[model samples]
Each structure stands twice: as structure tokens, then as C-alpha cells.
Target: MAGFLTTHVLDTARGCPAQGLTIALYRIEGGERRHLRTLVTNDDGRTDEQILPASEFRIGDYELVFQAGDYLRATGQAGDAPLFIDEVPIRFGMNEATHYHVPLLLSPYGYSTYRGS
Candidate 1:
């Protein structure tokens, strides 16, 4: 069987999908971070394509950096400096041959992520 990686983001403050949010996919190896690719959330707060489709699925540790401050500012958040939540990094492991769905529910001050479908 094959597996894939996917993600979703929601703006808790606005109580809606976090559109235009910037995120990146990084592969961690030997205590070092490797640059992969950056993606922007669509209208549904999801990447238009899978982060790692089955064809490219592999067992490893990955990080998704969500640009919280930028998203908030672009979404009409006023003022700057001392932002509670800036770039949020979610690191997770993948070892099973099944879908890995990571979803993020976020606000300016905090955020949360969990295994999702």
C-alpha cells in the first residue's frame, strides 16, 4: 500500500479557513533541517496538491512552518512587534504506510495541530 501527506489550516480568530497562509515542508535528517518547498493555503485553507503524494511518500521527520504573523497581517491584523505567535513549526514523524493528515487550528496568540483524516 501507499500513503501520502496533507494538511489544513483554520483561522481561529476569524472562525474560517486560513486563506493565503504560507507554509513550508522541510525534511529533517541528522539533526539538520533541509529546505524542501513552500506552499500557500488556498481558499479552503489547504494546499492545492498533497504535500507528499503516495508516489513520493517516505518514512521520515518533517516540519511545516506556518507564517502566523504574515497571515494575520495580510488578513487585516493591525499593529506589529511582539507578536505572540510568529512562525509556528509543527514537527511530526511518519512511518506507517497510510495517509498522514495534519491539520492546524490557529490564532494570533496560539495554535494547535492533530492527526486528521
Candidate 2:
């Protein structure tokens, strides 16, 4: 899975996967955001499958939106206006057969992401 878009969410505050979190994938087409698909993280804080299959990958600007606020509210971790981030958007490009591992370390007050292997 080194040639696909994958993600994992860790709840730093709770020290576990941010399961049940909604993630949306989008691509910029004609200077606008087009909805590609949506997925929910599993018990392991990862998508059930690879987001962008290597065979169908293309070079473009892509976005991954994480609904952390909703997840926190639903999990009773915070209110509608959580102190941490609400939606986390990661923008990147796919120019070759490269694995894009975007993992999020989330807390009630902050979050961080990086380009993983």
C-alpha cells in the first residue's frame, strides 16, 4: 500500500484511534473542489481500504477533510465547538506511484499531521 492514499487518526487525548470519524476526500477540478468520496475510520483508526488505488491514481491537488469536531461531540469528548480543530484538511499532490500516508494526532486542543510512508 505504498502507492496509495492512506490515513490514520489517533486521539492523543484518549490515547486511541479516533474511530467513527468521518473523512472526506476531494479533488480540485477546474479550480473547484469536487467531492471524490467519504470514508469512516475503523477501530484501528484507519480507512477500511486504500483511498486512491495505485492503478487509478493521477497527479493533482487532493484534499482530505477530517470531521474531528463531530467525532468528538459524538464520542462525548467535547461540545459542538471543541477546543481543538474541527475539520483538518490536508492538501497534497500525486506525481508518481508514491504512498501518501497522512496520519493525524488529535487532541481536544490541537492536532498534527505529516507525510508518512
Q: List the residue pairs that clash in candidate 1.
A: none
Model 1 C-alpha lDDT versus the unseen true structure: 0.89
Local accuracy by lDDT, each model: 0.89, 0.84
**Where does candidate 2 have its weakest 10-residue lDDT segment?**
77-86
Residue 99's lDDT within candidate 2 is 80
Model 1 CA deviation exceeding 4 Å by range: none
Give each model a TM-score: 0.94, 0.89
For every candidate in turn, the CA RMSD to the true structure comes to: 1.1, 2.0
- Candidate 1 lDDT, 1-117, residue by residue in tens: 798999999998889999998999898999999978788999999999998788877899999898988998888762567777889999999988899999999987778999998
Prediction 1 TM-score vs. true: 0.94
Best by TM-score: 1
